[model samples]
Target: MRSPKDFFAPLALGAPEPLREVPFRPSRMIHFFDPSNERMRAKVPDIAPTVDVLLGNLEDAVSADSKDAARAGLIEVGKAWEPGHTQLWTRVNSLDSPWFLDDVWALCHEIGDKLDVIMVPKVEGPEDIHYVDRLLAQLEARVGLERPLLVHAILETARGVANVESICLASPRMQGLSLGPADLAADRRMKTTRVGGGHPGYLVRTDPVPDGDDDARTSFQQDLWHYTLARMVDACGTAGILPYYGPFGDIADPIGCEDQFRNAYLLGCVGAWSLHPSQIAIAKRVFSPEPAEVAWAQRVVTEMGDGTGAVMIDGKMQDDATVKQCRVVLQLARDLSAADPELAAAYGLETA
Candidate 1:
């Protein structure tokens, strides 16, 4: 194992030095699009400006026969694309897939400069991250990439969730972790077929109504992925990396999608996957701090001047801990506002 002093050192000769801290950006929506599809490829330029991160999907959705086309298309997109503030990311095939090596090889050599993060699917432990980290260093060295490409692991398999903490701390290149709900559910043998959102059957009933009719008892749907999401959040927080909620498959159910996204937002996820264009608005709305919430956080920070002493604000107690929480909200607003003028106005961050 490498010593603490060498942890941030380059893994390969001539490779760029590792980052000391994972930079925080406005990644409120990881909007996915298949690069192999001509129509989708056509829309990327238009879509890139609207989303915080545009991910070129070369796996799962792209059929085996189309994988080559998808990779080439992504390279083309990367070369032509101009991502002002939006990040360019891609979901390469799982490390075990036959196409993985070629995918990494070509992207690193051809478009390493444009690419931001590589989302590796089915990562089960720190070992997987170590392999990717070394490989990325070698490739970055070959291409003379000035900036190191970050890796984002998808928490898909049961094993991945089990080793989530280790995975987050595996490498300095670890940008974040995204909870892959559908694959994780399947791996965990969960009965629900839905990709995300609450399952009515996975909830608790109102004490069976005691002596009253059990049929009349109210049943409130609890979040199915709450425990896992919370655990992932804590792990990511401990590692100082970002956490994101994966895709919600039900595109038709906008309300349910919004609910799932909101739950993730409240539980510390910075963003979520947007499989459909319609989900973009939902993610943006849910992930961003509301105007009223920003106002409240601002009030708390203003009243708790220097963020040291205790004070009462609108009948609520404000302390050092609460001020830190308020700062988190305010900082997110400021980051989002930097890229979005309308959001700046909403959060009252607009300067004359």
Candidate 2:
């Protein structure tokens, strides 16, 4: 392990200095597209502007036969597309995969300058990040890239979840963690086959009507991934990086998708994965603070003045703690509004 004094130093001789802080941008939805799919490749330009992060996926969904093509396609995307406000990222093959070496070497040497973050899948521990960190620094130094690329880990396995804090603190390049529910479920041997949302079987039922009518009892489905997501959020907060919700597979069920995204948002996730085009709007809507919420936060900030002492707003307490909460809401609104004009107008940021 490196000494604490050298933590922020570049691992490679001439690599750009490690970033002191992981920059927070508008990452409401990490929209995934299969780079090998011709139709998907054609729509990238149009989709790039609408989403906060566009990820070229080369892992999991990409078949073995198409992995090379997907990598090449992502390189092409990096070359051709100007991200503007949108960040460019890629999900490379896992560390254990045969394609891992080629994927990392090629992308870093080819379009390392354009890539913002490399999403490493199935990262089980800090050792995985340490490997990627050194490799990225070497590649960045060799390519003479001015900016060091960041690393994002996918919490896929039970082991990954167990070592999450170490993974987030592994390197200065550590950007964030995204909960990979499907693979995690398989690894932990969970019964459900769903991706990232709540399960009906995992629920709470109201007590029987005093044994009068058991059939009249109401049951509410509980969030299957809540505990894990909350833990991930806390780990991320402690590390000062970002936390995100991974894919919700039920694309046909947009309402359910929104509900799941909102749960993550409220739990402190900055964003989620959007596997389908329809889910893009759902993510944007769910992650952004509502207009009414923004208005309420604005009122609280105004009422609190210097964010000291206590006041009462609408019969609710407004103290330092509550003002801090209001600031969190307003800060998110401000960041999002800077990129989105419609949101700025809706949040009254245009005037502010």
Candidate 2 local lDDT, 1-352, one digit each (tens): 7899999999999999999998889999999999999889999989999999999999999999999999999998889977589999999999999999999999999999899999999999999999999999999999999999999999999999899889888999999999999999999999999988888899889876654887778899998898899999999999999999999998889989999999999999999999999999999999999999999999999999999999988899889999999999999999999999989999889733
**Cα RMSD, each candidate:** 1.2, 1.2
lDDT of 1 by residue, 1-352 (tens): 6688899999999999999999999899999999999999999878999899999999999999999999999999999978589999999999989999999999999999999999999999999999999999999999999999999999989999899999999999999999998899999999999988888787778775557898888888899899999999999999999999999999999999998899899999999999999999999999999999999999999988899989988788889999999999999999889888899998889732
TM-score of each: 0.98, 0.98
Q: What is the lDDT of candidate 2?
A: 0.94
Give per-residue lDDT, candidate 2, residue 274. Answer: 98
Name the weakest run of 10 consecutive residues (lDDT summed) in model 1: 202-211
Number of clashing pairs per prediction, in order: 0, 0
- Measured with C-alpha atoms, the lDDT of residue 100 in candidate 1 is 97
Cα lDDT of candidate 1 equals 0.94
- Alpha-carbon deviation at 298 in model 1, angstroms: 1.2
- The CA lDDT at 156 in model 2 is 90
